[model samples]
Target chain A: MTQPAISPALPADWRDFFALTKPRVMSLVIFTGLCGLLAAPGSLHPVLAFTAILCIAVGAGGAAALNQWWEADLDAGMKRTAQRPLPAGRMDRESARDFGFGLSGAAVAIMGLAIGWLPAAILALSIFYYSWIYTVWLKPRTPQNIVIGGGAGAFPPLIGWVAVTGDITLMPVLLFLIIFMWTPPHFWALALFVKTDYAKVGIPMMPVVAGEKSTRRQILAYTVLLVPLSVVPWFIGGTGMIYGVSALVLGGVFIVLSTEVGLRSSVPDDAMKPEKRLFAFSILYLFILFAMLVADRFATIYGWQA
Target chain B: MIDDPRTHDLELFRARQKSRNRVLGSILGALAVLFFAISIVKISNQSHKKAEAAAAMAGQH
Candidate 1:
């Protein structure tokens, strides 16, 4: 077999493969998936739940690896991602590609065999959506890339719900919608701060393609949508008054920050205070919303009415 | 297809490392699954015994 000559310039090892998995992102995905599994009404075998979480982690890792592999050239140009495994020449591109495919295939197969078909199917879709559809196609083509592509991240809770109940319900779909609406504000804030890096790399992120004013306007729009969507689960009776109050309070704060970001005009070249504030608060918003979901789940489980 | 000796040697090194890592990963994965299974069985058994004792006491009463 005639293998291509290994690039002597880039000597990579196993650690590079691990780094390509984007462990930080995988942590959030796994946490939300676990929360969904735990919150669902149906019972799942403990071992099965563990397997489901593991599969979600593996699938997320695989997708992240493939994203790194596909975006290696662009990543090399971006200061934020210049140190990634592929761009840093710590791993051969082909190796990363193979590892991603292997991990993704194993994760989907294990999910289907051990858990259920619906969750496995959703997992498979998420992997492909991120790896190919989002990374390969949408990323380079449009500024609304993150908007459509956010579905990949939003699937975890739904996958978790399906893992437990073997069906998709309105509640999980609402959970999906909440994240979907939240993604634009969260990511666009980061994009606004890193617009120059994206512009230099020729990646058409919202801030780069649409300009900061338009991006901020879009962020406000999404935040407005998100605030209402956040309270939907409570209104629908999937969650309790506690989550309702949390959603309203958190969503109110999110709107204030987003409005500030929209109204601000004199931000310094190197200083992105509004963007930074939005990004920091966005993490808190998602965490509190999901935490409320889990709290409500426990309340119901313990027979606490309200 | 210029066969550089250094490149060939590097390829050989990578192939060896890949195989070693695969073997190690598989062993660790299998061991983890076995350990979890054993612990689950033990816990379930203990719970079952407790339930059985409670039922017996109830019958006596």
Candidate 2:
């Protein structure tokens, strides 16, 4: 149990407020959401398209701010999170809460009025799901927090598709599932190395509660599911050869990397080469997969491939 | 509130936050006005085009 610190003089700067948004995470969310919008069959007015992407980004940032606010005390215990505005005592808790709610409310309202209500509703749900469901309800209680909480992150692409097409479809649902299944392996890899941080904070991450063997097995299992799920869009003729080939190669590499992580045992922190490699490659895998999806759409539109 | 010695820092922080909120509120207010104007222009443009097309059809008839 980490007690809150008291420091009176250090006021939070603008950068601290920006950091509350988790800009790095927001980047991936924005990219995937943009890809989903591009890959959809129909088109939207340029202004409306921009509005949708902005809403997704702002909503993501708001959720991140709320997550940090809720975890400020727990974060004070972890080395990686102690420097955050709230934990560092540079900003008040009420400030973060009010800022987060303000951004989230504005984003949802703009999305609903400018684009469509469906996407706006999903965006609102994503923020609530991350801030309340994952952070408050699940993280402290269960080792399966990442699994259930994965739905929160997966909403971006689904919302993007709805923004473009005005409804849900098999394609958007598949995109949602792809991210959903991908989250466990992605986060578990990070949890493997940061197991101590989670344990110290009393957060029931898989590695802390279930032991390393179970965590590794679960990681590999998710990777196995994700590999097939990733290839389904291509198999269903939703994407062309370029996307199909990229998914196959990326999925194969993901499996190989995950296998290495699972098979290795008791590697030292300084020598955690395989786990580090898997974690790095997983991010690249998603980026390239989504990029290729958009590239494949352009290829079709340009008559570059049949 | 700032006169309370025990809570001076807290009151100062609250005042800063309120000022920031006021700035943000003004920006949002401006943006809402802009969006409303754009919507009105778009709607009028669409109506104008519809009237022109209707006139063209009636002339042919």
Candidate 3:
């Protein structure tokens, strides 16, 4: 067998560097950040809120770029990521690394100056958590990687809350927990479908290391935990009954999907159906939950706080 | 390494340069759109608040 080349031709184009940032993922992060800002009780200048969201987006993008840079080798081996900018020889490793670092640093500094030091500090911590702790240390080491690394994705809403309030509270923490618990089920569903891609790349995702049965069981367990957790914001009065009802309905559907994924074995070719359904519903679940939070806030303004 | 014939393929080099420029242009263009959208929203919000205040004063009279 011929030896595979390690580093290929470098893409001199700047867009290749941009591709490393994962703009699609950044959009969700920015949206959650905006929701956090809008739902907070405190007031913020419009410009300042915009600045905060921008910084969150940039910081998320930067962390993503760093992740791609670090995982370029693994990416090359995985069919799903084989065509990524770094792995496809569309960008050089050193350049991607530098771009990630520059964006992380600049985002933190701009946030500190334009917003406040607290939010800026949180932004910096999130970047470090994602780029260094999650991507570098945890991801390749253990199957529990996504569990602990999920905190990085969960931080945006908390950062958005802090951007307005300049402090942490139980409400923001609840919001963080909602996303924290939501991450595993959402990602693992995708992982179930993509296990082969991960295994081919030598990455030890839960499905690869523990087998499909265990991964399915873990997904169900997380979904069970997530249902109760999603309803907690309403119980604690951070949100109202509109959110409570939405959470209950959405969470119920999520658990049903998870159970189906767990119960079915030797699924027909199309019967991995539950996994795809769960993945699609998971996105809608989070969106509806956050949208309810915003809607409930407006309801309170209109004398429907309950 | 510097004298490689592949590096001196002028047409390929020009094509790469053109693609790079186009990508950069699109990114800057998107950023411009985002900036203007945010600016317009802020301006409209301020105007709405002003109108609300004026309406409240008229009602008080």
Clashes of each: 1, 0, 0
Q: What's each prediction's TM-score?
A: 0.85, 0.86, 0.83
Off by over 4 Å in 2: A1-12, A268-270, B1-61
Candidate with the greatest TM-score versus the true structure: 2
Task: Give the alpha-carbon lDDT of every model.
Answer: 0.86, 0.88, 0.85
lDDT of 3 at B26: 89
Cα lDDT tens digits, model 2, B1-61, are 5575546666666666676677668878977875876586558757988999999999999
Superior by DockQ: candidate 1 or candidate 3: 3
Candidate 2 displacement at residue A164 in angstroms: 0.5
Q: Could you give the TM-score of chain B for each candidate, in order?
A: 0.77, 0.76, 0.69
Worst 10 residues of 2 chain A by lDDT: A2-11
Rank by lDDT, descending? 2, 1, 3
Candidate 1 regions off by >4 Å?
A1-11, A268-270, B1-23, B26-28, B31-61
Model 2 backbone overlap count: 0
lDDT of 1 at A133: 91
Ranking by TM-score: 2, 1, 3
